[model samples]
Target: MSMYCNQCEQTAKGIACTTHGVCGKDPEVSALQDLLVHAVMGLSLYAVEGRKKGITDPEVDRFTVKAIFTTLTNVDFDPARFQNYINEAVAMRDKLKERVGVSFDHNSANFQPASDVAGLTEQGKQVSLDSDKETDADIQSMQQILLYGVKGVAAYADHAAILNQTDEKVYAFIQEAMAALTRNDLEANDWLGLILKCGEMNFRAMELLDAGNTGTYGHPTPTAVPLGHKKGKAIVVSGHDLKDLEELLKQTEGKGIYVYTHGEMLPTHGYPELKKYSHFYGHYGTAWQNQQKEFANFPGAILMTTNCIQKPQESYADNIFTTGLVGWPGVHHVDGHDYGPVIEKALAMPGFPSDEDNGTVNVGFARNAVIGVAPKVIEAVKGGAIKHFFLVGGCDGAKPGRNYYADLVEQAPKDTVILTLACGKFRFFDKDLGDIGGIPRLLDVGQCNDAYSAIQIALALANAFDCDVNELPLTLILSWYEQKAVAILLTLLHLGIKNIFIGPSLPAFITPNVLNVLVENYNLRPISTPEKDLEMILG
Candidate 1:
């Protein structure tokens, strides 16, 4: 196989993408990502030892997580960027090795990456996924599960750190997990335990991220976000970073430019700090999967703050820019938060010629908002006004069967409340699900990273009703596309929540044996049609 990646739901033919990634990642870029991951694995070796000696480097910790996040699906497709990360990883690894005064005969610990991208690609082919065929398939699956879960945790940890909220435990677990991937002694059961531990670490990382976002911007209040555009020069900020959006908003204030959110940034409008900007106007487009078409029609500049960026079309190639860990070849990369170039681009372009009132969608029903009205919610449930609650949200994708989410949401009984999050809500966000007892039937719980909020809301309800979360009349019908969703699933399993129905397709990395383990242990099932699944769930 020239390249092997099955980290997402839309892998080629529902199996491994053996040639090129379906996410527009070429073979060379894929190879470089593989090598970068191996290099990080090497750095993690020394990092684990350095911690044992009570010596830690903040640069190493930060770089380790950021580098892993760079390799996540749809984050960076630039081979040169991956090459730089690989070089930096090796340099930090050797620097730590010198400080610890330690040496090892293991190939991973002593490996050296080539100076050139061509040579590094060769090195990558050697250390690619499943390089060690001697390992059991189930064990390999568990190891990959742990690795991807760590990637999700790294993404959250990086976001949290950006907001000046961080915990060393998250970094330590990332390094330990990467270093553990080099070991040959762990059994399948042992790997399973580590996977659960990864889940626990993910929970902490997400908690830190929750605190960072809410603390930095204040808890999101119920806000109405416009779906239409206003007349002015405009910039649409995509991805999941609120700080980036805040910085752009600050720079563009009084510049006669209107800032609109796209994709996951839609939730940022609910933040008090970000929404305080008068020029922060409305939301444009749907999820990342539809960006190419939606962006082509947009008349202003585009700033991608994080992942979920696609190959830009020729029509708007000059209008799109990427920042942070998100990168595309030949696309202008903005460093830090200096958005001067973006502002200039937006001003240079012709924004909407006339205003369009496309109505609005309500966001900001996070844990705080939901729990703020716990009495009302609990009373509604007790009074038999609200029936079962369905938590139906996750990463949206371009693959078939994703329409199942919109179908499920539409067909959901009026008495049932749907608590949604992530970009997947775009399928039915505009639907007037109506309210019960002054409570909106649909509650947006924020981004995929905000799963902690959903968990807290569930726990609060469970506490109010005096029952386990699973015992409550709530069901999780989730759709996943990437590692973040994988991490959230692991967190749910770690919390001992049962009967999670995930679709449209399961992870390709999971072996049948490992799948059986999750199914048996957690009662996890692949989602059937919306009709069948809803019947089974609501019955």
Candidate 2:
């Protein structure tokens, strides 16, 4: 069966993945994701009716959020697992149907899947992105945009949920938005508006996730983390979830296993509670794209807790462990916070031969961390000590063009201050960009969810400079990979932030017309070369 998946920035040749997903999602897995989306749409139809009756199911809401998140690129490659989620979704929808006193409409919202994998594959074939024969390419693009943006929202919300943080508003929007897709009356413009609304809702989801993180782990503060620490029985934990890392830390507390962070997990070192752990040491690897090589070379077990998981290499497959929403067919999965096997594997492996001393990278400049130094930054800006502020961050990938981000920061003028977050910062985190007096020129503002922190810092700068945020001497040079970047880009556009530079490539989901609308309304531009983009932003 043919497939069509272009949900990530790194889609094959910058277009839909037809035969096989570039992210290692084979035809079967791609079909399952389509089926899962169809199932969610089915559940949303009933959930919508249930909401009208003031009888919403929190469990259904959670399921809808997670089901969509699991279908995202590079997540949940196991078709068998997706089949379970789909059948479970049908049950949840029926339960809601009983509560709303609404009879089944026999629409996709109530349709059951076939009993076998072949049947599920047949069902999925009809639901691929290309199968929707809406002649208007722009409307088709907008629909894809909304679905992708919501997937990002679900991922962030799922992270917060694991921390015991749930926003009913977010869950409600997830189902309501999915239900909107089943209706044919909505036009391209309608879907476009909904996409922006998803962006706004995503802002709230990210805010809740941020609140959950700070509430549990305490606010992030500026902390220096080692980049090369290969000592002892090392276990490198990657992805963005801090809760899983904390649990691993607790279980390995006195076990003598060295717990190091990798990729997005690098920001966890800045949290007060997490940083308190003596063995919660340093970072390993770079971004999500380098996992095959990085994980292969690591001395011990690798645990991935969230999105941005690559197909594990056989070299490290035996030691790779997946948890939460992350999955790769044969890899070990840890559930119920049981790190017993992971610990056992780490302990059994030979420890790092010696500490390489690869120097250090600084992170944890979240809202509280940066805002405390706001007055000083404001003074620096007013005194002509700081020339411009460039927020260069987002999801990092393995694209060869991604080196532009590191070069952009490296080549910035002497007086400019660079603010960065998320895994993208890994490109230049090791580069020494000098400092303004005691303040570092490159400020690490935690993870991608901490984008709200970037917004707060931007607003504060605007207030200090006495201008609209767009009027301030700030530029957003972003590089996006997946749906989370879509949500953040929409948030920036929603706030009227202008002249933002985004690259390595634009999303394949956006049609030429929809792309024009964004460009005309927001002046959002794709990034050029480091030399060229820097000139445009600085000028």
| Top-lDDT candidate index | 1
Q: What is the lDDT of every predicted structure here? A: 0.91, 0.86
Question: For residues 123-227, what per-residue lDDT tens digits would candidate 1 score against the true structure?
Answer: 888886567788888888999899888889889999999988889988998999998888889888788888998889889999999999999899999999999
Model 2: per-residue Cα lDDT over 1-539, one tens digit each = 67888999878888888888778898888887888888888888888787777877778888888899998767788778888988898788777777777774545766778999889888888876568786477777888888888898998889888888888888888887888877768887788778878888888888888889999999998999988775699899988888899899999998888899888888899999999999988888888888898888988988988787888888989999999878888889998889999999999999797878888888888888888988998888889999898999998887669989988898999899999998899888888888997789999998887888899889987887788999888999999988888888877876778888999999988888888998999998998898988877777
Q: The CA-based lDDT of model 1 is what?
A: 0.91
Per-prediction TM-score, please?
A: 0.99, 0.98
* Winner by TM-score: 1
| Decoy 1 TM-score against native | 0.99
| lDDT against true structure, model 2 | 0.86
